[model samples]
Target: MEKEHKHHISSYFAHGTVLVTLLVLTVITVVVAGLKLGPLSVFVALIIASIKGTTVLTYFMHLKYDKPIYRIMVFGVFLLFALIIGITFIDYVFR
Candidate 1:
């Protein structure tokens, strides 16, 4: 017989908290977009987006309670994406 692994169930309060945080972040993003900070607006938007993405991945996607391998894979993918973006920017700058 195989042993079944029990999953951790998140509370409604936790989900609500995440939802509220995402909503707040959305408002902040909109406010930042209205500021017209030139290049800095994009950077601020990206940072806020990253935070919202991480929150969704951790809570709604249940990545926080997932196995180590899954977390590692997600982190690797994020790292790869960041590296690609960095390289693209560098190429653009040098051209």
Candidate 2:
């Protein structure tokens, strides 16, 4: 028995738009790095990086079209990562 798999096709224009958006975000990150915002710079960079990561995961990795369970799992992983980072920061601030 042969099982047929369904695939979702995305347009080149959509991918091009994603590429442009990522490039714009990279530029913004660079510009923000040049500013002397002290601790805020790290927060800003992390924020931008998180956005880029989500974009890559959603579109480039095709997670957007995946099942809801997969999305929930990814969210859980990200939540764990955030919690670890927060704990590290808290420890650093106190020490």
Residue 92, candidate 1: alpha-carbon lDDT: 94
lDDT (Cα, tens digit) per residue for candidate 1, span 1-95: 65567898999999999999999999999999999999999999999999999999999999999887788999999999989999999989999
Tell me each candidate's TM-score.
Answer: 0.90, 0.84
Q: How far in Å is the alpha carbon of 77 misplaced in model 2?
A: 0.7
lDDT of each: 0.95, 0.90
Model 2: colliding residue pairs: none
Estimate candidate 1's alpha-carbon lDDT, on a 0 to 1 scale. 0.95
Tens-digit lDDT track for model 2 on 1-95?
54554766878998998999999999999999999899999999989998998998999888898777779999999899889999999989999
Off by over 4 Å in 1: 1-4
Question: Which regions of candidate 2 deviate over 4 angstroms?
Answer: 1-5
In candidate 2, position 22 carries an lDDT of 96
Q: Say which candidate scores most in TM-score.
A: 1
